[model samples]
Target: MKPKAPNVHEDGLLEYLEDIIGYKEKQNQLKDKLSERKKNMLKQNKITKILKINMENLLKIIRIATIFRGERTIRFDEQDLIDLKEELSRLERFLEIEENELKAIQESLKDMR
Candidate 1:
């Protein structure tokens, strides 16, 4: 005898299985995205912290340079001060950008909740 064709209930079960598979794929994709975002946030935070420390050290150097500017034994040129100030400005801008990016990633994580 010939084998029987798939009944309606079997077809319905197959559709349900397919749908479950699709949902599982979507869930995995979202998890991957969340993991990547968390890594980026961590990296950004580290970069921001390092930048702040460097900026603080630069400020200290500038202060010390100013203190020695009046001595007849030690002299600091105007061009040297200008160069230090320019470097400080660049670091500040870089830190600001990193902070803003970190905030954006945090906001996205919140929205995912």
Candidate 2:
């Protein structure tokens, strides 16, 4: 006796195809988002590195100035003090902005997952 053929439902096929397409689209979107996030993180990392270097240099300058002051060999003019204060304030603002941006990115990543 010949074997009977199996039946294939068109509706099931359509549903499966739709699901696959949706899944693939979702995957592509995720990949794009991850790539963009990685690039942004790398850029941020570079900025952080530069900021770190700047902080270290600033600290070193302050330490040297302190040592010189202790020895009574150097004096900070009013303009010099004002400039240093402005620079420190600028750095503080930059750090606050970066922190907030990082927090936002973290939230976005969590939402993606």
Best by lDDT: 2
Of candidate 1, the 10-residue stretch with the lowest lDDT total is 1-10
Clashing pairs in 2: none
Question: Model 1, range 1-101, lDDT digits (tens) per residue?
Answer: 11332675444654566567785576567667666766765676676567666656865676676687754333354455456567656766765776676
lDDT, model 1: 0.61
- Root mean square deviation (Cα) for candidate 2: 8.2
lDDT comparing candidate 2 with the true structure? 0.62
The 10-residue segment with the lowest total lDDT in model 2: 1-10
lDDT of 2 by residue, 19-80 (tens): 77795577567667666766766676676667666766765676687787786333454345
Clashes of 1: 0
